[model samples]
Target: MTELARAAAADPAAATSPEPVPTTPDGVPRGQPVLDRLVALLDLERIEENIFRGVSPAESPVRVFGGQVAGQALVAAGRTVPEDRHVHSLHAYFIRPGDPRVPIVYEVDRIRDGRSFTTRRVVAIQHGKAIFSLSASFQLREHGLDHADAMPEVPDPESLPSFADRVSEYGARLGDMAKLPRPIDLRYVTEPAFLSRESGPRDARHQVWMRADGSLPDNDLLHVCVLAYASDMTLLDAVLVRHGVYWGLDRVIGASLDHAMWFHRPFRADEWVLYDCASPSASGGRGLATGRFFDRDGTLIATVVQEGLLRIAS
Candidate 1:
């Protein structure tokens, strides 16, 4: 077993749970429980051909994690596409916060089906109001011109400890931040947690190695959903750290505003994918960051862009 695999095996949360059944008989484990719970709580039921209604849990807050809805919506859309065609890109906007106490309906519109591509449009609604919308594209694998920019060299995933270790060491100092859901194993390459105090202007780029905590099936759609879940982990934080604002700092209040991603090539989430990210600007209480994902062989597999609300506490 790999060191990461060992670390995951040692984790109580990961080790104790019964193996999760995939959404479909042949599907893979998508491993985002909060998302799974949201899907279950919403009691997603098919209302029309290729259309799904997602009801939210009464226990959740109205404004949902944009990533959760986006990932789930992608799954809903992927279910309609052919197995060979994998999602290549997705763009979405959070028009409003979804009320968790109520159900959010997801409607998938099949826009086009071509020899090599399929497009889908999704609208998420709450209380008879549109709350979020997304457009996603899928592509059939084919031989094509292939080249990728060089992967940024960073510390290997083996050199860093699991995030859980860091949190256990810090204990109560991390408070609620420590309890954030972490379905993927993450290890920082650029900024080790120990250097936060000795820093000057921080490096704009950040890289992490990640994969699902459990074995996943061979379906491509499950990998896409897992990518969507892991994508939200730390890209925007690169923007904040560029200015030296760690999460616990008194003045920082950051939340993701919008997220977009494009898959460039085929890759497995079970393997280490280096998330190379950088921040371009931060002004007017918002910051933007972009990232590229590269497999172990340096194949560029995806690109991600996100903007977040960064505010100073009064």
Candidate 2:
């Protein structure tokens, strides 16, 4: 989708017709059991030795979400690796907005399989062109020295406002977007972008509590893939809040340029995790943010860094 299309989707008054309801390929409505549908999305269809096909939710946003593509790519990479190996790190770049109307084809290249580490590269293609690419490294489990920063003292996830509760103030502005099926549950410790933009010029820090909205089966790869999808939901809001500008409320636009994640320890995505995020710099029409994932016990399990295009219209 183009910039104009994004604007139109965000502005209810600009909509020319009723927004379409999302559905499954079998023509079943999809607003409930959202997590089931999400898991299905990650279940890619293998078409060749190293090629797989995945699809987007019906009537998706102007573009397929960045996290969806990233998560799906990881699934493709994981499928080609040995089950004994687990993904330790992944680096990905979003080259273009994905088209949701069609299926995405992921082509995987086995880069290396060494004594302790395995690496794979995946490219997500649509209409025979590359839209995204990722390189992931898997490792055989082994003992390692461990140390991490302590999790800051903050209110528990239950004390914070849910995403729906936080956005209730926006009223009809968000339309069905706010009401759509959400597979991930998010609660904010700080004012969200929409709310912060009114009184902010705040610090470049954002903290949120996140977990899958529903129960997930016991699968290590599935848990990690789910975490990858949840990571992109708000990692960049820290940048916008620092300037007190929002996407629709302000004359601003943004897109993920690249994302990288490192897994430090095992964790369940269905359990609450604190995502502590901050933006250290933004320049040349881009903003860079980093986040650490900590389980409820305050054990750091993962780290993420992402740079995104944040164009402010003057």
Report the C-alpha lDDT of model 1 over 1-314, residue by residue, as the tens digit.
Answer: 42223434555453344546433121222354533342233234666777776654343333566666777688778767887788989998777876766656788999999999999998887878887788999988778787779997777888887666655655356565555554576777777433453474587777788876555445567667778868987787677667766666446777777789999888877678999889989899988999999998888999999988888888
TM agreement with the true structure for every prediction: 0.80, 0.89
Per-model CA lDDT versus the true structure: 0.70, 0.86
lDDT of 2 at 282: 98
**Top model number, TM-score:** 2
Model 2 RMSD in Å is 9.1
Residue-level lDDT tens digits of model 2 in 195-263: 888796899999999998766666688889999999998999989999998777778889999999999
Runs off by more than 4 Å, candidate 2: 1-32
